[model samples]
Target: MKKILLNLVHPDINQSVVNKRLLDGIKDLENITINNLYQKYPDFKIDAKVEQKLLEENDIILFQFPMYWFSSPALLKEWFDVVLEAGFAYGGSYKLADKSFAVAVSCGGSKEAFSETGKEKKIVEEFLYPFEITANYVKMNYRKPYITYDAEAGLSEETLNLYVKEYVKYIKEL
Candidate 1:
């Protein structure tokens, strides 16, 4: 099986229902390295070299987080700025080419909110264009994102359980 790198980056996990449950479900899985970014770098000071090393060691990279204001938290953005440096992740002497990247995210709004008939009236894919562009820049295969909607409203126990199972399946398949 291919090694998978699961990068969990939630700024406020204590208040996150969907993400916390998802993490709890897969915390003990094998052949998967779960890097809790906030826990590892509470001071907001990331180790670029170590992060780069981790990126190089894994075959599939998963960025797991709750969608905040249509994007990721500040630290995750910082991680990209610092770790995915020039001549490494993109630009001259790029190294991330041919790698795989995917996003596992949860949104507070329902799926309808991301469609023409809903509030935002725009697809989530359109909102996540930047991530797709980044993956393209690094020449990585950007897989379809795995999303859980209306997370704040709370899901049925059965539905939540299914979400966890599907999440694991998504990561494994990638």
Candidate 2:
């Protein structure tokens, strides 16, 4: 079976209600490697070589995080900056080329709040453009994001369960 890497990059998981539940639902499945970035790099010191090795091994990569200030947590950004080196993830060499990348994110606000027709003044797709651009640069297939909205309010067990099922389905398809 092909390997899928799920990088959980939540900074404050202790305070996280949504992401914690989602991750708990799938932490034990076979063929999936869940790398909790914050726990691994507590001092923000990411091992570039190790990250590169993980990327090389996995056929599909999922960046799972809680949306903070419309972006990834500080540590994930640092990981990208340090690990996605020139002549590796990008440039001509393109180590991640032909691999699949997807973002599974939880937003504190409601779905309506992330729309031009609503308060936040941008679509969820627009908010996720940075990830898409990065995936494009690395020549990876940028799958549509799996987003859970109103995350701060906490999800009902039914809703969380549904999302977890969908998440597993999404990974299987990739």
Q: Which sections of candidate 2 miss by over 4 Å?
A: none
Estimate, for each residue in 1-174, the C-alpha lDDT of model 1 and write its tens digit: 878899999987888889988988887777889999999998989999999899989888899998899998888999999999987887786677888898999988999998988999888888888999999988888999999998988688888999999987887678
How many clashes in each candidate?
A: 0, 0
Clash number for candidate 2: 0
The digit string of per-residue lDDT tens for model 2 on 1-174 reads: 879899999977777887887788778778999999999999999999999999999998999998888898999999999999998888779989999999999988998999888888997778889999999998999998888888877678888888788877777777
Clashing pairs in 2: none
Tell me which residue pairs clash in candidate 1.
none
Candidate number with greatest TM-score = 1
